[model samples]
Target chain A: MKLKELAHSRTGDKGNISNVSLIVYHLEDYERLRQAVTAERVKNHFKDIVKGEVIRYELPKMGAMNFVMQEALGGGVTRSLSLDRHGKSLSSYLLEMEISLES
Target chain B: MKAIRIGGGAGYAGDRIEPALDLMEKGNLDYIIFECLAERTIALAQKEKQKNPSKGYNPLLEYRMEKVLPLCVSKGCKVITNMGAANPVGAARAVKEMALKMGLQNLKIAAVTGDDVFLNIEQYLDSTIMETGKPLRERYPDIISANAYIGAEGIARALKEGAHIIITGRASDPSLTVAPLIHEFGWEWTDYERLGQATAAGHLLECGAQVTGGYFAEPGYKDVPELWNAGFPISEFSENGDFTVSKLDEAGGLISKATVKEQLLYEIHDPENYLTPDVVADFSQATVEEISANNIIIKGISGKQKSSYYKTSVGYQDGYIVEAEISYGGSGCMNRARLAEEIVRKRIAYTDLSYEELQTDFIGTSSLYGEQTSTNLIPEVRLRVAARCEERKEAMAIGQEVEALYTNGPAGGGGVRVHVEEVISIASILIPEANVRVDVVFEEL
Candidate 1:
């Protein structure tokens, strides 16, 4: 299954960093999300785009996780030559991350 | 327990004004905030100021003020905005002039200045730029604009002085919403908890429609109704700091727990350390509950003492970027697009166009993901070539090379478009709070 089945995400950018927040649809799925979507996994998922380190912050109360990717947005929005300067569509790309369903 | 109703007017510099006008007309707002300045917008505005002294503010200030000023005056609603960009005084002056022309009286317009730190750039020459980890002196000559992200103190002071409209340059986006809360409730600068809560409310409202269903829609997954005419957000805050997010009943959009939650963490890195000039707001334990349709209560947001230094955005001339696109269609369109990309790259190298970096992308297949994208032959594809160069002429050559593909190469190529724009990149640095002094100048009409 894909992470989109249990979660939705939103992407925001600041300078060369892009932060994507993944929120679970239900609180019950939060634990599973926390286990599956690690910072290492996120870093690997965006290895091509993000050149720097990825730091993940947990919002357990809100059943969400925030991933901050440095050296993203192709060196920031104002200077980047990328088509999507802000990398706003990164949330959708993150949603495509495959998640193994709990048996 | 008096609750003050505040409406988010414009989210960014070019946001729609209709929703804001709707708030003033029907939402019964005590204050309306327009958070218009983005990270690099003020820097670009500075370039404009250099060319013309009188014009550095948001270009839409007159058009927006002309429409909302009368409504605000008649309804006794105060206005706050960072639409001043590089020049708050000029923006305030423009608003005062427009208000007088519109025959609106008893309006006290305040221009909050002192955010611009270019005059005292020498003092920060030794400071390290957070982005590049380099000394400020390294990029001193290339620096175009340097403005410190000021707190709500100046805005609160303006409100205290009975300013009907406040214009500011480079104030933190959330501070636009937080200022009125401080003024209304008389919250002290040292009150970290209340400041934190207010900052959360401001953050949620800062994006306007983002918390009201504009960016929350997903066709089959998370459906939002009437998103086309999605309304901007309005929050009612009690003196104690708890607030409820909602929109006009007749307005289009959703204000569910989901929308609010998504926006709560939007652009935020750590929920616990969401830094603003006013406070270091903690949203980790914040709770969102749907009290009713289009009404959600946000609570449990706390704050800590703010940092001693103010985060400053330094804008410099990065160079020029030229982007050119051409579409191809047919059975082998993907191959044709790749061929065009190769042709452009070879042509640029052959012509010796001096560029720092260059990239070629097939729009439909791999423009966004690059090499990671799966290659599948598609019926149509758009070939896009973009290059960054120090000189404008070098940037123009890349675009010209792409445009030449219409008649020079690729079968069935059509709809070629090219754009060459000067890049104004931003860097972050910190300045001591004491070094930056904020002053509010008032103009009464």
Candidate 2:
């Protein structure tokens, strides 16, 4: 199964850093999300775009996790040569990450 | 027992004004905040100010004020905005003049200034830029604008002085909401806990409709009804710091736990230490509950003392960005687009265009993800070529190469479009709060 089945996400950018928040549809799925979506996994998932380190912050009460990817916007929006300078589409790309449902 | 209703009006410089008008007319709000300044908006406005002395503020200031002021005057609701961009005093004067013309009397408009620190930028040349990890002196010559993110103090002062309309430049977005709350509730600057909660409310409301289903529509997965006419957010905040995020009853959007939770973490990196000029708000423990239809209460937010330094945004003239796009459709479109991309790349290399960076993207297949993810044959694809070059003439070659492909290279290539724009890139630096002297100048009509 894909992560999109269990959660939805939103992408926000500040300079070259892009932060994508993944929130579970149900609170019970939060623990499974935390176990599956590791910072290493996220960094590896966006290895093509992100050049710097990836830091993840967990909010168990809110059933969400925020992944902060540095050097992700190709040197920020104002200077980036990419079509989507802000990398707003990154959230959807993150949602496409495959998640193993057999646990 | 006292609570103030604050409406988030305009989110950005180009945000729609109708929803704000709807809020003013129907929401019955005490204060309406139009948070318009973006990271690079002030820098662009500074360039506009270089050409015209009195035209540095938001272009829609008059258009918005003309509609909002009359309603505010009649309804007795105050207005707050960072629409001033690069010129708060000029913006205030313009609003005063417009109010006079509209026969609106007894209006006290305040313009908060001193955010622009370009004249004294030399003093901070030795400081290290937060983003690039280099001294500001490296980009000193190219620096076009430098403005500190001023806090809620100046805005609260303006509100306390009974300024019906307040205009500011580069004030932190959340401070727009926090300022009014401080004035009405008389919250102390040292009250980090309340300030944190208020800042959370401001952050949720800062993006206008983002909290009210504007950005969260995924059809069957996460469906938001009437998103086209989504109402702007309104916060019914109390003195104790907790607030309820709601919209007008007749407005077209849902205020559910999901919408509120998504917005809570938007653009936030460290949930525990979300820094603003006013306070370092902590939203890590924040939770949302839907008590009624269109009303979600947010709680468990706190804050720490603010940092001694203010985060400043420095805009510099980076270079020129040239972008060109040509679409190919019908049979064999993918191959034609790929061939067009290759041709443009070879043409730029052959012409020896001096550029800092360049990229080619097939819009349908690999523009966003940078690789072909799907195996299905694409019927139509757009070839986009973009480059950043030091010289304007050099930047134009990238677009020219793409345009040439319409006749010279690709079959079925159509809708060729080219754009050349100057890049005003932004860098961040920290300035001592003492150096940024904020003052509010009031103009009466």
Candidate 3:
């Protein structure tokens, strides 16, 4: 299963920093996410776009996780020359992450 | 027993005004705050104000006020807004005149100023750009607008003065709601923990309908009903700083823990220390619970402390941005799109149209996930070319080159759209909080 099967994501940008929040549909799936979605994997996934470090923060209360990508946007919404300056589609990219279902 | 219901009106400068009107009509609210100013919006507004002294406020100020003022006055709901982008006094005056014209004779409007540092530009003569750490004098010839993000003290003072509508210039977006929470709850400025909770509520509600499932709908997977008529958010802030987020009755949209959680982390840098003009909010410990259908309770928020300096947003003339798109389809669309891309690049290769940065991407094929994502060729694709230049005509020429691909090249190219926009970029720096002073003046009609 893909992350999209159990979660939905949203992207927000400020300057060159971009934060993508992943919210799971079921609380039972959070442990699966905690085991699968590691910060190193996220940093490796966005290594092409983001120039700086990727930090992941856990929110067990809301069953959500925030991945902060530094230097993710080309420059940002204001300074980036890319078509998707705000990187709004980046959330969809995070949702593309594949997750193994619990047997 | 001290509780106030406030609605988030306009999130951005050009967000839907009808939702705000609907919020006022049906939300049973005591106050509605419209957070309309973005980082670069004030610079653009300053350009307008330089052109016309009486203008430079929000573009939809009259239309929004004309639609909501009558209802707000009747309900006695206090209105707080940062629609006074470059000119608070002018916005207040505009609102006052509109109220009188609408036969609302007893409206009391207040304007908060002292955010702009144009009058004291010399103080930053030796200052450095916060992002790049470069000297300010070396970058650009002009600084369009240098305004600091202020706190909620002036707004609380305005409410104490009995102003029904408070218009502000360059105030922090969250402070618009935080101010009202302070005034109504009699919370002190030094109450960091309580202020953080209120700031969290303000942050949750500042983006209008964003926290109420408007931006959370994804159709099949994350489904939401009646998204077309999605209602804006309204928060009931208690004296203890706990709040319930909900919308108007019979309005569309969902307000569950999922929506609130997505919003809680929006654009936030550090969850342990979220900085604002008012407080250093820590939402890490905050608890969210769904108490009813389309209503969630948010509580347990805390704060560290606020910094002694305020963040100043400075706008400058970066350059001009030009974008042109040409779509190709039918038989050999991807090939034609590639040909179109090459043609645009070659045509503008040797011209005087010097661009600082240029980018190209195929919309249907390689826009987001890169070229590796699409193994099979698509039937259709959009070839988009964007360039940043120092001159308007040069930027326009970049578009003209792409538009020429219809007759000059590309067999199946159709639907050519081009845009040339002024790029007013922004930078930030911090200054002493004590250096900036805020004053609230009222006007009655």
DockQ, in order, for the candidates? Answer: 0.83, 0.83, 0.64
**Against the hidden reference, what TM-scores do the models get?**
0.98, 0.99, 0.96
Error of 1 at A65 (Å): 0.6
Local lDDT at B355 for model 3: 91
**CAPRI tier of model 2:** high
Q: What fraction of the true Cα-Cα contacts (under 8 Å, chains A to B) does candidate 3 also have?
A: 0.54
- Candidate 3 docks at the CAPRI level of medium
lDDT of 3 by residue, B182-213 (tens): 88878778899888988898998889889888
Q: Which ten contiguous residues of candidate 2 chain A have the minimum total lDDT?
A: A94-103
> Residues B1-445, candidate 1, lDDT per residue (tens digit)?
9999999998788999999999999999999999998999999999999999999999999989989899989889899999999999999999988988888889999999989999888788898988778898887789999999998999999999999999999999889888988888887788998998888888888899999998889999889888988999999999877899999998999999889889998899888998888899999998888889999998899999889999999998888999999999988888888899889989988998888888777888887877787577577889888888999999988898888987898898999999999988888899999999899999997
The best-first sequence of candidates by lDDT reads 2, 1, 3
Best model per lDDT: 2
> How far out, in Å, is residue B20 in model 2?
0.7
Lowest summed lDDT across 10 adjacent residues in model 3 chain B is found at B368-377
lDDT of 2 by residue, B8-84 (tens): 99778999999999999988899999999999999999999999989999999988988999999998889999999
Considering the two chains of model 1, state its CAPRI-style docking category: high
